[model samples]
Target: MGHTPADANRDALRAANLRRLLNPASIAFIGGRSIAGAVQRCRDFGFTGDIYLVNPTHAEIDGVRCHASIAGLPSAPDAVFVAVPAVQTVSVVRDLAARGAGGAIAYASGFSEMGGDGTALQATLLETAGEMAVLGPNCYGLLNGLNGSALWPVAHGAARVDEGVAVITQSGNLAYNLSMSSRTVPFAYLVSVGNQAMIDVAQLIDAFLDNRKVRAIGVHLEGLTNVHAFSAAAARALAKGVPIVALKSGVSKLGAQLALSHTSSLAGSDALYDALFKRLGVIRVKDPVSLVETLKFLSLAGVPKNGKLAALATSGGDAGLVADLAETHGIEFPPVTSQGRAALQQVLPAYANIANPLDFTTTPWGNPDAMRVCCDALLSDDPGAAIMILDYPKESTGEHPDCDIAAHAFADSARRYGVTGAIISVFPDLTPPDHAAQMAAVGVAPLQGLSEGIAAIGAAMWYGATRSRILEADSLSALPVLQAGQGTGSSCLYDEWDSKRMLAEYGLTVPASELVPPADAPAAAQRLGFPVCVKVVSEQLPHKTEAGAVALKLDSPQAVAQAVERMTQSVAQYAPEVKVKRILVERMASAPILELIVGVKREDDFGLALVLGSGGVLVELIRDTATLLLPVREEDVRAALLGLKLGPLLTGYRGGRHADLDAVARNIMAIAKFAQAHADRLMELDVNPLLVLEHDAVAVDALIRLDA
Candidate 1:
């Protein structure tokens, strides 16, 4: 369906309001002592626009004449900062919205985050704001370094930049720290989206994408408010060539609990977040340092064309370190071309090793011409990225000119060759800020610390590759909208026979079997085949093996009859309430090359996730699994299958015959289709020990649960 006129009008209005709130021409502060600090921060940041203070108790604040209230202001301000109590905040927002104010930042704490009365109060605040954009009822507010606007209520270390990365964090403290980061990541905007009662991270990302000055976006997420919205915004960023780096916390159970209480957010499954991020082409970083470093590299050097890297260092130890770390981070160092090696041999010392991570041996250390030649030789291979390791002497020593020269030479070489480049320091503090800034000015990232710098390069490469693939395929315009499932109620389980039959209609391969009364079990087994497997078919015996209700490889009628009698006794002992009225007898198949468990898990918020992993009786002991959000394509299923720990076995491991991977993937795709079709009523589904043979794949056992 196409967007309607109402959608267009709403989008336009949102865009306009965001612009006014983010880059306002005039700002108003409404509160007590906190307003003074906010006003001073604006002045300190060189905000040239009008600044109005509204306080009924004070005639003047911070030498600026104060308006009695929002209505008493000289004119409706473009942006207002409300630092009042929760209940009072609603009235203030109502007054501002009535006066046609552009937007307001609610800086109070007691809102939806506190629950109970706070949630109702937050609803009222949202209703009162109406069309006007409201930031949060419990947030630290925003800092626009580009326009020198500080709606934030406290001091921040951000400096104005013409263009840089915009960082939006759920934690106000994290945002504050990012603003004060010494890594010198240029900042266009920093927003702490606490509570996210109104404008969430997705909306902030969308708003940032409209500004060309926002070179990239860095998000520090405790949890996402809306997965589909975030996916759409991320897709837009990918299409626009603006990279997104995410630092996602709350991955652990304890952390998720804390995150829920702190921001009232659902810290959904981390594995699902991984799938979502990968699908959207967003770079996911594990720590703050990596986030800052990755953003710095992307903002300055831009993304590399691929993962191949060419590295240079003055010492062999440094060169070796770079090689080891690069491998660890999955950054490849392609062998230097013969022509490139001949060129490097001409400039370097005779003892120097002619390799990708070439050590120039300090012979041309301070000589700019020779160093540039050395750099050019290394980069002549046309590597996707290049890095020079240079640790500068402390400024107090006054002997870092050679380091600067080397950095400049490498930057020059990278630019000449048209490859992304960075100068990495062995230690975080070794890279002087002045030199770092100079390198950044020349479009070369001056990265601190070897591990983080290499990891940043790896991330950039992944982003580039993923972005290219996504753009080429145009796969992720938006995530599939999850429909509401069946209402919460008791769920009924489909036993093995019924489950297998239901799945067979959807293209799953199941063993040929006959269901008969307990008395006819032996006759049914004889009719099927001599060697057969018999199982007591009952919903109460979902786990037949554990309940001793299953007997495998029964060769004769006598064996089948005796196994059936033992199964009856076992079921009666296991659960006396369950009657063993029926039995399933099926032909026994050959041993499988590998066993796998394919299942669909449904979460209240995240919808269905397809889980692929090693299977059989040791499934839990092995615990090797890969998860993907549903509505997945055939290629997605193939990738997930190949990424598992036992995946190597399917590819002819240790002289073993290769399993038919295509057949396996196709079967899994069938399962995914079935789950999607019954998504509304289906609660859970499991196909364990989906036997993979040399030429075929079959689902030997299955179970399905549906909302009753």
Candidate 2:
């Protein structure tokens, strides 16, 4: 999509009418016969807008007045719905812009989506709509139920349209799917940003943030043209206490390739997107179903004040399954405290397990107080935000009473305690009558399966926890600009010493190293003392171990010379183009230590991400990397380091000596600060085998890339 300065100006103008234009007063349709079918559908669906049609040939369009054009309209409407021919659509939008039309839903195609001449034509349309917001040139249009403007083709009908959540999607088909699909949740508005040449999703988000009635914002993005602007808009929304849920379509390489075929979108790196979401505090969902379920919860019931969650299932198997899933998603399932157990024992029989996710055995299904006991425990005593009641209704309970009564009692307790609740029932063949309605009456929903319900609630809870912590943009400072052809070349720009020098300048503690050419290798090793390592310095072979370019633990000058000769010959054979800069001779530490890799990459969307993991050959195979956004706090850095699989190894596992982890955290913080301070000039920095000895840490090897 090609956007001009003029289009940006138009976005600024539309951003001003953030409230009124989005929730328009009365939307006027400009084409009669062409969009007569669409117009009648809107009217039939109970659109409260004054639909004035414009057709010079007819006085009425399906019983509505057909004025010649906006010039001959009865009044200047807040918005215009343009449904003219593809060739004439641009000219009509130009006229609407001239006539003080605040915005338009351009429901015509044959522009940029096609190639060559069509792109030029689309550029012209964008230039002409320079001061007014245009939703689409090839689109199904938008819906703002808050203002009674139903510009979408599908009818919302009696599907809970009030107090709705807003949607913004890059693809028009996906936007329409939200309205037409089997949506268990309600919506407030939907905008399909086809060829976002004029007004983009960021501007649309600004509009929604201003609307007090709009509870949450959901965006389905294929590509983000401007990450800086998008990040700013997200911060604004977060500041106003509105949650933003995103379903980013192109995060994986395969997914990016698929999106390119589907929407002609150029997706960037998945790692970059992950880092971006972490920095901006955006809740990223894995699939479309998860997106809807998460938004439904946040927009309606909201999250618990605390992170603790408790589950009560009739089956111990189901309870264990939910607990395992919760742990994987980072939800803290604090086991029922000693105090909590004492409280639960008073109400429950001796047979019931007094643990978290209490299983009140088979026969207890008949008792309703069993329901009250479990609900009260989680709600009043434990004080959790949400609860799940796994009910498995069966016909074989011949002598027992109704199970629905127990479910009702549990839900009633949930409402009384002001906690969000839901049901996960696994009935054999048929569903109990009015299960969803009965649950909904108590502000709860029924989950069909145990795993499915837990997954949905777990996803929603994870998002809720993350979204609330999204910080304001003011916390960040201005980033430095990257020079072209700098960090991105066929090969990295820094040699071993140059790389280490760059990192050391940025505050990282690098070991003593000297880049000694083949001639001076022995002399350098002798000066540095014995038990040193010699490695081929070539920007070409980044992972030198696999290529036989690295040699470790040389005790003598003779060994150093032989290692240098072998490395030189190997580099000549494997990587002929690389000028063997030197054989870097550095001090090699002893064993009884931990080896780790600390690296930084300039992510495409998120500026920089710091990675901490086990170093050396297993770096790729074990893949124990834990990532954190750059410019992180000291505590956050410590958390990121400790979160890794190898983190405990550094802390002395299995009676091994404890390494200096506090020094390691300080080193990571220093690296992060370096990346943050010099992001413009540095593309990547890698410190492999940062030897954690008993008392201190040493950077055994280092690599850095700078702007070319």
Candidate 3:
């Protein structure tokens, strides 16, 4: 996304009026008889709106009144669907805007997706569309199930539901595929935002929030345009009791390149998007199936107040299967209390295990009363949610009747106890559509696949919990109002000593140090104290130790002199043209408890972000890091630290002294504030090996890359 000022109010108005445009009483379809135009959309959605066709070659389009051009319309239609060649799209949109069309979707290809001249033509289309909000100059169109209004090109199978998930996708084909998918997830709206010249996905999301029937919003993105706009809108959705799920493709460099060529939009850093999504209460999923499954769970069950989950199955394998996958997905299965176990013991035979993911052991098969008793005992503990595992018979063998008894037992038990109940089929294809519908009618979801169902439930619970916190904390109020403008100075790197000095100004504890030319290194080391560390200072080298430019533990002045000589020679050997300008003489501090890395770097789309993880020489090898957006509190840093693999170590592993975590948290806060202050001039800041001792944390090594 380009750097642009966020306009929530102006955008809100455009989005608010989208209801009229999307579900307009009248629509003028230009290029009436073209491929997948006017005729297909009207029939696809069963649209009963007044349709006016415009084509010079036809007197009428298939019994519908046809005008020669836009000028011949009887009245200014609220919406216009343009399906013309790429060259004619700009003029067509210009005419619509001239006559005051409420909105227009230009369903044409060969825009920026074609590159070269097409990019120029797309720009003209945006310039031509003055007040009219055009969804795309090259896209499929919108599918509005709630209002029976669709601008989509092909047949989209959907029926109106009370409230369903709304989806917005950058790829027209993806939206088309989703519409045609056999998944049981009902949809309220499907918007295909291709080559978003005027109204991007973020703006469209703001529009969709107006519809009270929208349960959740799912987005399929090639890339994001205007992150702050998304942030603002997502915050609004969070406030409005809306959940957002995003399946963001193209996170890899090669994948991003393809996305850029396909959409003419830059795939900004995925790390930035990840940080922002988690911060803003968005559930990020991997694929379209997961997106739909997750949304379905959210729409049906909402968020569970607690995560203590339980599972029931006739087979021990199914019980263990669910328990294993649930753990992998972070779903908890709370243990049954001794009292609850006693109750379950009575319901089951001696062989049946009274445990979470309890196996009923087929002892009560063909007996709904016994099944109900077993379920009631488990529900007595009042687990947040529960699922019963059953595999329906494909044929009417003698055993087919048992499946119904199990299903009815689950439905009856759940309704009686008022627990959120779900029936899981071991495989997706096991449950027939009719049987699934029957379960849903009884207030039980016939979820397919154990892993998929468990994952959806876990995600739904997490989103619900996260949204409540955001609403309570009013986190939107905490998001930074970015400081505008760019720095004029060029970027330059600073050596460790200089970097530490800058950090020390903000109250960071650094080892006692001095900067001096190599010839005076001995005196500097003596003044700094014995057992000093010497390093050749050169900002040109990003990594000093790798270049053999550092020497540690010099207990005497002679040792310091020899160390400086060796470091200077090593540095010159590594980079022959580079000069050893100075050397840093520092006290050899005692070995600390742990080494940690803390860094701040500006992302193109997400602004400044911080990274904290394992540090020292194995920083990259460890690859255990957490990324967070700026303006974080001490508690936020502390929480992030505790979540890391290094967390247990920080709490004093094997009876070691607990590092001053409070002081570390304060240090992070101070450094973050310093980064914010110099955001304009700073590009990157790192304090790797921020040593944590028994009582104090110190910056043993530092590096600052400034945008000058």
Candidate 4:
């Protein structure tokens, strides 16, 4: 169902309330001594806000006078931390809402996440909160580093930052752990959205986008409650030039199962999430470390204009390692210009390799002037970004002024050239925190660890390029309406003949065919052409070749008749129940340049998705495919086809005939349009081995399942 105007107004109001809750002028802790730590944290963070304690049992708790009840508080607080039990949490929330409070954090678990009675309690909590924003019934709550307010229940390691990345996660433990990261990721806020009973990750993202201090948003998602809302919020971020980095944890089967039991989060198709992220320019990272590192790079150095990078290292081994890792991450190192190499020759020793990922040799290692000259030469080409690998020595070892000098030179040169840059450490722990902070001050990302640094750079490059494309195209303005499917009804499968007939109306080319009785198959084949294919027309047998119900290369009437007889016997033996009454006789297609699969998968949450991949018998074995949400354009289809392993074949691999790619894309778009038209009832559709010939694309075999 679509959201009404009233719903929009309520959402706007809740967003306003959320702003006050996140950065409150006054905070109230409505519990006993258990919440004293939380109150203390706010004080330690330098939150100059009114703090109120409410407890009927104790006159004084944590050296602060306690109120008898919510009614006894001086005035409605901007934010409330309800540490009461699950059943009482709702009443506390109701009282706060009645007092016109901004928002509250339900810190106790057992609601909704525990199921049964807990689910009922959660519904009441949501209804009671009404216009007031609620964080979670089971979460640890939020830390606002921008305003120096830590509403969190436990001790956290985050410090105040004027501007930085905001990290939001479904797991409070993950949020807590990320707060303690020593990687120098300037954190503006850390939010743990537990069950998402009232406010979800999408709403938080939307709210964060309004804050100028939030340079980027990093999210750790087990699953999404609202895919559409997330897409919209991500698009807004992309347009506003604030990147979103995601760490999704439910890719594996066991992990998905665990996610469901842990938080009642349904780990929907990961591929669909990939498509959604790709569409909105959200960068996806693998681990928590990468998440922090990527956000650090984005927040500090910002995104590069392109994937091209210029790397510098003192040792040959470090240079080679950078080259290999850059290649692995799809980072390009455009060769240094003649001007750059000529300048490098003047500063460095003759043995130094003057190239991109330049090994500037140990001769100029300790010389700051030579290092700066080499850095200047490399940046002369105006590469999209640059990185200098420098690992600091242990403090016990010595001062290690060489690394510091090299870092300063790189930082100064990058600033002079106005290029995005990073000083990457080979080991995560080698970079000194003081040095990292100094580099960050000059707008150079002090990235720790070689592999992670390059990965972060790669992610930034992808975001830069993809963000430009999405903003220019404006394709994510709105998602296609999700079509409601018939509830738990038996599905009817369309036989090959019928499926082809339906597809042909939508501009897909299909071979001339006739569906006749099995006895008349030979006559129909003779009328169609000489060399034809015959297949038993039974909805039960979707895979005719596996059932031996299909015969190819029937060049004569006798061949057709014998094939039909064989197919009938094969079907009887294979099923012993299905009768092969009708047969589809079709003219044979010429040898295809390449075979491709065009399919439409209807998912419950994401709606229709178009799947394109290498087709034919090895489709499953090859397992090469790309998925896109439906209502796709022709360019989208073409790009997906080109991304496949067999995609090169379409361009005439090894001097073979080139398939008409435009024609192929058109055929796929036709299938997409057909899927959109039937989105209300279509369950699934497959066109296996959509033959890509030199001149045209044809759907030789097809099937469709619809709610009956």
Evaluate all candidate structures by whole-model CA lDDT and list the values in order.
0.88, 0.69, 0.79, 0.88
Question: How do the residues 459-528 of candidate 3 rate in per-residue lDDT, one tens digit apiece?
Answer: 7777877877766776667654234226555788888888888988887888888889989999998898
lDDT per residue, candidate 2, 1-708, as tens digits?
679987677556767643445777667777756556656766565667777677778887666668877787766667777877777888887887777777788777777767677779888887787677787777777776655576765554424456758888877777766777443455778888876766777778877887777878898988776666777787677567677888888777788876665444567766556656655556778777667666665665555555667677767887787788667666666677666677677777788787777775665556677667666766665444555655544558653245676677778877887776766664412335365546654566555545445555665566555555433224533211222223445445676666777667756767666786788988998898888888887667676877678898899999988987788787778777876777788877767467889898775555677878888777889898777666676766676667778778777788889888777877778777777777766677889977777877777677777665
Worst 10 residues of 4 by lDDT: 478-487
Which regions of candidate 2 are displaced past 4 Å? 1-11, 31-34, 37-46, 156-160, 181-183, 313-321, 330-356, 359-374, 388-408, 425-449, 463-492, 516-519, 536-549, 568-583, 592-594
Sorted by lDDT (best first), the order is 4, 1, 3, 2
Candidate number that wins on lDDT, 1 or 2: 1
Provide the RMSD of all predictions against the true structure, rounded to 1 decimal: 2.1, 4.5, 3.0, 1.8
User: Which model is ahead, 2 or 3, in terms of TM-score?
Assistant: 3
Candidate 4, 608-672: lDDT as tens digits: 88999998876989998999987687777788888888888989889989998988998898898
Better of 1 and 2 by TM-score: 1
Using lDDT as the measure, name the better of candidate 1 and candidate 3: 1
List candidate 1 stretches off by more than 4 Å. 1-15, 478-486
